[model samples]
Target: MARTTSLSGFPEWLPEERIVEQHVLDSLRRTFELHGFSSIETRAVETVEQLLRKGEIDKEVYGVSRLQQDEDSSREDALALHFDLTVPFARYVVENSGYLTFPFRRYQIQKVWRGERPQEGRAREFTQADIDVVGDGTLAFRYDVELALVMIEALSELPIPPFVLRVNNRKLAEGFYRGVGLTDAPAVLREIDKLEKIGAEQVSRNLQDTVGATPEQAEAALSLAAIRTEDTSFVERVRELGVSNNLLDEGLNELAEVVGEASRRAPGKVVADLSIARGLDYYTGTVYETVLVGHEQLGSVCSGGRYESLASSGKKTYPGVGLSIGVTRLVTRILSRSMAQASRSVPSAVLVALNDDASWSAAQDVAGQLRARGIATEVAATAQKFGKQIRYAERRGIPFVWFSSVAEDGSPTHEVKDIRSGEQVAADPASWQPPAEDLHATVLRAATTDD
Candidate 1:
């Protein structure tokens, strides 16, 4: 085995843990495709200018350049590894607008790099599963609801604890802030985003001191953030606050539509949470933040929102709604807490035992037939003793082992043993089948234990 050193912010999983991660990626991909989202992967690096156009994420962007440059070489456009899939997808849309149909829906599952501190659920390099729908010039509000529903369905397929998709609208927030006489709605929103981390009192203070809000305005902002409901009643509660604006009315209607439709479709999975003011400035409409039940400390395991103008050509603009699942973060928490695990560390379901050097060719022939039937089979390496070969299969978590020999009638005989149950039975390589459950490595949810 080769010696290894660990990197602080970059995570590498063991074989079993990787199995769990792959299962998650596969599940999300299937769900995305079922919802009519085609998959696409953008290049890893993008121009720094294109990246910095979004928001103040410059601190997290990892710049890339040649290690050695010729003294006389002209400087090239600065490039950096993408921090998220949304920005790159935006650029891709603009670059390929002519070829793609309107309302292009895409799903991307790829590794993204961010220069952030190493902490639980936060990494410098991680995999994110993203789904977005972009339209030329204009996008429909129905897509906002559709993305939420699709994300809720995808997450429902995972083995994690139950979750709630908390959603909000930026238009509602900005409109409310403006109604309260605050000119810099974005500045207020940035402070409000920290309400959960820094507490309502500190956020209120920041609103007054940093964002230049009056005491009443800060109080109203806190009040709005406190409103959360599982149904459309949140609209009535906001109306009771006595704030009114055309933008606020539009936001209220959009949010009600999302919550109302999503509730009917996926009950107990969606909420109208006014406090979910996503810190990103680009989110123009509905924003989402999901937390696993009983694991709130992990923060939002999935998050995203709507962007009205992230992608645009000279004559056309692509507005979109999207959501991303932090695959690495979810997997890290699942493994650390024993929430789930793989049934086996390796992919092989059956191991063929060689009786002797002469039987090696026969073992290979049997393995070939098994592989042809879609069974994952491997032949022993050195034709070791029967017991020793079985032990090797056991160590690898291979459930079944095959033995072949010549019968008294001079006919080839094959038998397979279920090592876990110690049951051996005659089987033909061309016809025998393992139980469906044992055909592949499966992700199993760990049983709950009393504290």
Candidate 2:
């Protein structure tokens, strides 16, 4: 049965693109584990109250309910699919507080759902990979700096173009607002966050109308947000703005430490960008956003920050800092733009050809030997003609084709042909090995339009 219509906002990948996604996820997983972060997963659903604990994100959440003859919706707590991993992870931390270790370092990669309108890079359902470090009562600031380094390390190893990790301090923005006699800092930050979406003139108007900011104060906030430096020089730039507050001083010092260390370790990989006011209400300290060199229009493909009391029991508060990569969005862009591709569409490197209907056993035997030698081999599905079998392998980009027959001495003999080079050689299955990179499908960069 075929469906009459397809749903919008839900995206699916073809085989090659799925392979590329797996490669990207595997690379991130390895990097996270290398930094001593353990893997974790949370339930897909949380109570409606828990999901709404953050703010007005309810418009994007999908609520869950059962429809039956005797289903009592009032008797049970309302449940909804999680829109992001962080919230559920926080709930898990609180629920399992006694079982988990303090300063928990964890990495979660899973599918999350939302009911938002779809766009070029946004989807209703997508995969997000997050690496977070949470501490009971207090989290160290070093994790805030080191998380960026780890993300940079992981992203550099992938096929994407060079990316700059843009760092900021929420305190700087809020404190600056406070210094300028504005009390509603979050509301002002929200307007500033829309600088690109709603243009400068509109943001300035909203900053004045919504938060009662003076004309000069709004412009000063814009100037501060616009300041971006490749080194700790951003501290001086903030100082030049003439706003002073204890929080402002603390934010400047913390941002400087992060950008300074990032510069020394991986020069040019991180920058202190002043305008990075994360609109999310939770971020309390340093925040980050990343942009690909030539693909800034895609927006920040990875972003996160520090949170206080987001994960806590009444007795103790867990302050954690983390970053999350938009896996589905990245994969979708790579495939849509032809930025990268899998070397081959199929996993099998060699297809054992069937000589005749009676020779099926011989081909299977040859495949078994190849398998024993750690080669990815598959027997022909039918007793197709030799040319047809070769064409089958060619279509799937399988590199090698094997033919088998019995010799005069009644011993089975096997021959292999490299389809890519048209080179034929008699071989012993136990000793033959394909080139390391060719043994399985590999992801590689695709040629650009100019190339």
Candidate 3:
């Protein structure tokens, strides 16, 4: 049978592209570590019961179970691949509450499975970078502020340009809805969240038809949600709506503090967007969605919000706040636009050519010396022609090639060449070094067609 093609939205990049991906991951990990967020990885699978505890994720779950494990038909083991890291992390925090430190700050970067249909940036199998701070009921507000700041710094490290961290307070949205005579909080917020997709008129109509709102009241609520003041004016404007519910006042205060703190850290990065209602049903406090400036049409590259309770074991509540970067989406966008890149591979500095059968062992000594000096060197597997060996290095994007030659008098010498420049130099393998910049290939801006 003919080989099946790679399924769409399931991307498999070449070695060079993999290098770019790894570089992105490495930079993200470094930023997380710099902020003192410890790393933790949960298993890929969790019980369906554990996953469905939060009602919002049912549509995207990819269930898993053994195909032939039912011979006895008496025992059962059910599991599903995790759709997001936060839920599993919450479960881990609850179960291992005793072992973990209070105010736990952890960062997890892993592949998550979503059974949703594919789109341009959305994939069936994708990676996400999530950082969260869960506490033993005493998380400082500073942690919430820092989480957004750290994500900003991490994403800024990528080749992509600036992105806006659109933030809102769920409490603020709920409070305003209550003041507007709406009772069901999630249902109301869900409708408002569609404002970006559906026009304000349609959103207001939906509010009237679905959530029982008068036409004028729906327009007023949509106007409040559409309010996008630069700073404290957001709070002032929302209050000006004259929604008298105490809950609205409280939500406005909570968001005021969060936006105020985030502004102090990153003056222009965070904005109070009342209409930025994330569809997640769990968020009860501050919510966030980040969009690249030029790529706004690509939608949110990172998004999350504060959850009042992630796990309810019928006994206790776990309040938490976190954010996630859609790694696959952002990376694919970068690739398509030639926004970033990486070296061909992880090999350090040199590729030692195989001169002849007799000189193979001698070349090994040179490679051993280079390796001892912290250089990555590889010897050719076969003694091919000089041209063939040079092409091998070029194909791999190996910057330097070490050529070995045995003189007629049985003396051995080695020369190094920079394949790109076609410059060759005599060198002692033990002491030679490539320029620091030449040691690694980086993402280069694509040249114009005319060039």
Candidate 4:
């Protein structure tokens, strides 16, 4: 037999790490549900046409097929693992439009696959927690405002680095580009998307060679991307550019609304960064990019935006605004940087100690009783000395050890020892309960000197 190796980009967490991951997931789910967002799931696979219908991301898509294909198989064209949740969700909305409500609010948490080169915060397969509000034909700008509010609220509860959400609008970027004589704005937008990676010089050259943008035009594009404002003063700043268009005005009004409302509700959480022209072509309105306070190098940890027409039929259209948090990226950073800690490696709050081999089944019965009362309990696996049993519980971070006994008159009694504090107290299995905070594994952050 040979030892197996870990796949390069597929992340697998140990039990302790998974504790933090579950905490993050639970916190996200609670926040989303609290906001009245219903949950829905889409199939992991979608037709290749549905994925490629929007843009040229074929290289990042992983195609799916069976090991052996018959000549007469019913495979139409081909299928691929979805690279993101939005496209598949779009198809789902159109397919289920008839039965769905007018304003559909959904939260989808699932693994998505991407074949891109893996790096820190990047993976071949990852999980995304998304909340989208989709409307029939026309959606309101308030949803855009609400999206930012929900994200800031949800992320504030997670154990990770502080984050700042960067917002921009497609109309602003496209109008700015068009106002600068760049007709092929999408190609230019793609080039600008790589501005951080390829540097301003390379991006300018690509803009010129790829889209015939001159040096002046390239500088203007870079200039627009460089603008970042914390307040609604961004409106005046864009006006300072001295370039005006009807679409630009529309975008400015919408951006002002989102930024103003976001500032009023969740102060200092979001900012207007004009350079945030997201890579997706479907985004027709406001866009988002997020960076941690100290982890800007890792790029956006959460991102999504408004799409004017994502889902459509011959007569109907679905417009939406959404935000997604990359759960894997978040938990990875938490573990790698020691951003947080799981209070226990396992869920057991109390380990039932066995007095002797004859008491094994009795301990099991006691464990069941504690579990029935909503305490996480696990019976000792073997009959061991009390010291050895307590040692076992200590190794697993189990806080309490329960010892079974009977009174002189044959009445049942149990005592649980708190390993950390060395305190023993009488308890009844049906009535005993761990403190609320200790009832389950908890995720905590390491204290910092600044704190």
lDDT of each: 0.92, 0.86, 0.80, 0.88
Model 2 off-target regions past 4 Å?
A: 1-5, 69-71, 447-451
Whole-model lDDT, model 2: 0.86
**Each prediction's TM-score versus the true structure:** 0.97, 0.95, 0.93, 0.96
Which digits, one per residue and each the tens of the lDDT, describe model 2 over residues 153-189? 9888777777899999998778888898888888988
Task: Compute the lDDT of residue 58 as modeled in candidate 4.
Answer: 89
Model 1 spans with C-alpha error above 4 angstroms:
1-5, 70-76, 448-451
The reply for model 4, stretches above 4 Å from the true place, is 1-5, 72-75, 449-451
Model 4 clash pairs are: none
Per-residue lDDT tens digits for candidate 1, residues 298-406, read 8899999999888987766899999999999999888888888999999999999999988888899999999999999999998888899999999999999999999
TM-score of 3: 0.93
Which of 1 and 3 is ahead in lDDT? 1
167-214 per-residue lDDT for model 4 (tens digits)? 998888888889988888888889989988889899999998988999
Per lDDT, the best of the predicted structures is 1
What's the candidate order when arranged by decreasing TM-score? 1, 4, 2, 3
| Model 4 worst lDDT window (10 residues) | 1-10
